[model samples]
Target: MPVDSLPNSILAHMLAINNVPPPPLRSLPRLRLSKTINYGQLNALCHIRGLKSDQHSSLRLEAHDAFIKQYPQIYLHEKTVLPKVPHLADKRKSAVRLAEKKHQPAMPHNISAYLREARGGPSIDEEEITEEKFQEFLNILKKLPVYRTKHEHNMVWKILKNIPALTSQLSKEDLKILSKKVMSETWIKASTVTGDDGLYVLLTGQARRRIKVFRSLIEENDSIITSLYRDSFLFDAELKDSTVAQLYVPSKKLTVKKWGVFGSLKGGHEMNESDRSVVTDYDCEILKIPAKEYEKLELEKVKHENAKKLKLIRKCPFYETWPTLSIWELVSISKFKTFPPGHVLVESGTVISFVGYISSGYCNIYRNIVGLVDLPINKVKKMKKRVYMGKLKEKESFGEVSILLQAPFTCTIITGREVEMAVIEDKDIQGKCMNVI
Candidate 1:
């Protein structure tokens, strides 16, 4: 009989009874579904590994076997291995729990805990600096040069507060910036603090100005003269027009004491490009401010000085009758001046050519008197003595009488402290105030 026409059961029985192979194995549609799945095969029984992560990976990631260890076999009946679907009532309970978590009352407790921890940490900047520490910092800054102003002092404190030495922290990068940009150092005893540029100051130990010897001189007791004609000659070519025309070289060692500023400072007008070496006598702590930094601070000081002058003008009773334009013009024309203590603003016999408004500190007004009259009885006459006439306090004016009469004043005006003044010289106020004059 034809195998095609025979029934599969009858044909399989005949072939088994005749010891013949059961009708030749035939390919049938959908027959392969009954076979056991090979490893790493995709089928309807398994989905794309049910996205194993919260962030769904792509097919490219799947090709790289990222989806390995997903199941015992590549293809599995997902209904048996996957989590069971929740009932309607259970889903409703889950939704209620999620809502409660979203609207929880303890949220503020978490926020407050975070803030407390942040506060408990070490301070990072000036705002976090304690009062005691800030005061100590101010004291330390007094070691700097005299150019330090109240505003600049606070700013410098704020700027340097980030240093690890001050903050009690460690940072290689911050230290590098500070030591490079803000200051330079010399570690050895014989080394020079400022061999190049910048203002030099000693923090610990002492140093001396190294002066070259010009000649050797003999005295009663063996002595070396470090300076000759110091007060006399106009020696310093660099200080040609300055009042400090003479050169000075100290005979004593360790003349520059601790915390003493020596280079490129405001008061050091004699500082030149010459190699003036300050040899350290012992282990020294040195600090330096670059010339550029000094220039920047000078600008800020000028701004503050101008504002202070404006304030002083408003306080002067003499300016109360002046018009607003005149006041502003005076403010613009006034020269802000600073004088050191014991400085003679106007000598006793010299002409007083400028009117001064003492903006800060006090001054002593003195009249030169004949100590003893030149008499025939005494062989030598006594020198003139200075008698204190009065005090010129802040907001007081000087040279007003001299300017009014266009004559010289007999009294001497000496600064009692470092004084700041708003000076209006005759040349500056020339023809603009003819009506007032």
Candidate 2:
């Protein structure tokens, strides 16, 4: 029988009977004999392996083509196996590992010990400072050529100016005396050292003058003088003119007596006619005024009187109780005026200066008393009489409550006698005092 006409069962029986093993299943090598053979065998293999026939056939064909292109020698061999490949080391990772291995050990925990080791020796001990040691140091400093020089004087003055406590303790009069002594000593020293008057003139005439003026302003007690000192740039402009000296001379000589608690108690005792001693009064010429400048002199006199009034006001009970009212700030905004006897200082329902202090006299306090009855239109209007409150004497203050409350005065204040008052304006109290407090 022809091979193409044989029944498949009979052929399989015949092959099994002859021990042919079903004509030896076609090998993978046979599949490459023709493209048609490869496709048919691959599809049959896929069916037997339980995979999609078309997909498996395409994948296998592509892998076979790649293998044949890369290795033409082994592409046709069915039993060939690929050789093992070795992994390459990364150059960057190897270099990092080598650097870590070559580095020095970790640094010592103690910083000073590490520094000593690095420096190759122990460090030397610094000199200890004590009071005695400091004194010796000061002595050494004094022996230096730069000591007491013009530069040193300037440095010392700058130091003193910066220290408020030290400057506050020194009065202007004290600074004047100190300036004279320093100038004389510096003049002598400069003359001896340089063997010429040039250094002496530079030291005493220029340097010492500057020191005196600076120290005087720094230690000044009067706000007006301080303001003038600032306005004149440490008296540089004003001191150049001789006439300006006359304007400030009265302020320097004027003194205001403060009534302290002890002084008041003593004054009360001495108020008795028997205990009071008769005193003689004398007029001394404090400043020489030319006839042409008589009006200018009167204006200066008024200014001096006002400065005295302010000085006394600073010692009043109100200022003592509230120390935040800076004397300089108060003097800048306050007014000093004298009121005649029976003149009203403050009236009820009126806004005026917030507070006033009796500098040299007394004032009486009165409050309006409201009546209950309604008056007829034709009836004569009875003047509302104000009830008498107490009296405010010298060194006492009034109107602080009205100033604090920002309201009009509730009572009337009248001068009981000729009264000298230091009035702190309502605007000033709100502007300056409230900010500080």
Candidate 3:
């Protein structure tokens, strides 16, 4: 019988019954073995027949008594232990002692060995997990402390659980709903209220892909998530275009929270927070124009382009104090550019390298003000992009301030709608327009 197979109490009695060899002389408790038996002989006997110490004897009876008292309606089986301690040298005693302190008892140390003696050990079987049991396990995990917050670890698990490759048995609509839930509450930005433009653009793409892949994984769970998470996806997962990677199979599970880390490693493009400034609402001085005054400035600049013929610059309350230049002369003095709807024109902190003048088309200016605007003001207020005479706009210019002051671009400029504007370069404006300044 294996040493562990015998009950410790029964093994003790059996050892007493046999003329068993004693423990090693140096390590032995008070008793010494007769010279008739050597350490080798004692070891051989203990290998064939098991022995137990007082602590083990008491533990065995306690386990039995507790089992019997609780499970009177159920039958209890005989206990067994395997004698498989590997021999190690004494110099490792410190490490071995530490490990012994942390050791946990195993029920069947080896399933194969226990199966061979199934008629003897504890009554539990070597059970195979079923689909239902897997789901039950998942439910239990959902209730664990780890699942409460929207952490990357927890999000990954939620992704795996909610997706269909593992749960095709679930409904299509159910999977769609799960995908929706993932997006609505998953990874959120931890930085400024106005997102970094670079990060915002990248995240916009990521959010779209996460939603799509999450949908596809569930739709074709059997062939998709399994292949990707368990097989080939690792090689492709780090793409900044997460949507592309998500479309491909996972081969292995993704555990990282920050998607960019994976994207950079995979040779995907990275956008720095500096690049992401487009998302922020730039702080700009507002230039509100009366309808008639704005209309007159638009007519002269757009129609004649003759700075000398421009009456508005000479007559207007806003532009009168401003240094004067002729209409055609102003065109020569400034550079011109145009933007259509949805175009990002200027960014914050960028050198207000040049001042702009709106010749035509409506324009709007904005700054990031939290608890104020939900969407971009142009979108929410339905405002057209306009040139601010007092505030910065198409005909209105800014970079001159920096050139005059020799500072960086103080504010960002973005197009609210398509409009044509002139950029008055510092040299033309300072050398010529400032001839009047």
For model 1, how many clashes?
Answer: 0
TM-score of each: 0.31, 0.29, 0.23
TM-score of 3: 0.23
lDDT of 2 by residue, 1-437 (tens): 34333335334544453345776444212322221224443333323321222434766455434433332222133555788554445666787789998885785687854554353222222243345643443333334333455554444343223322223434543332232222222222111111111111111121111111212323348665665455442232234353333221112221211100001111223332111211111121111112223334446766886678667766886576545346656766777778899999889997666578778889889999865555788555446779998888998888777777757888898899899777887777897777653
Using lDDT as the yardstick, the better of models 1 and 3 is: 1
Worst 10 residues of 2 by lDDT: 256-265
Give lDDT for model 2: 0.46
The 10 consecutive residues of candidate 1 with the worst lDDT sum are: 228-237
Which candidate wins on lDDT? 1
lDDT of each residue in 1-437, candidate 3, tens digit only:
34444334334545563447543445433432222324453344443322333535765455445433432222233458889787576548978888987895666676744542342212222154345654453344334334544454343344334322223323443333332222211233321111211111121112112212422323454555564455322222334443434332221222111111111111123433222121111221111112233234447555665443254234433465655444446555555567796565555445554656665555445453334334755554334333332233433433546656657643445565677766676666667765444
Candidate 2 global TM-score: 0.29
Model 2, runs deviating above 4 Å: 1-310, 321-325, 372-383
Q: Which structure among the candidates has the greatest TM-score?
A: 1
User: Residue-wise lDDT of candidate 1 within 137-199, one digit each (tens)?
Assistant: 444455443544566455554545453332432144332333333533645665545434555
**Runs with alpha carbons beyond 4 Å of true place in candidate 3:** 1-303, 307-318, 322-331, 368-399
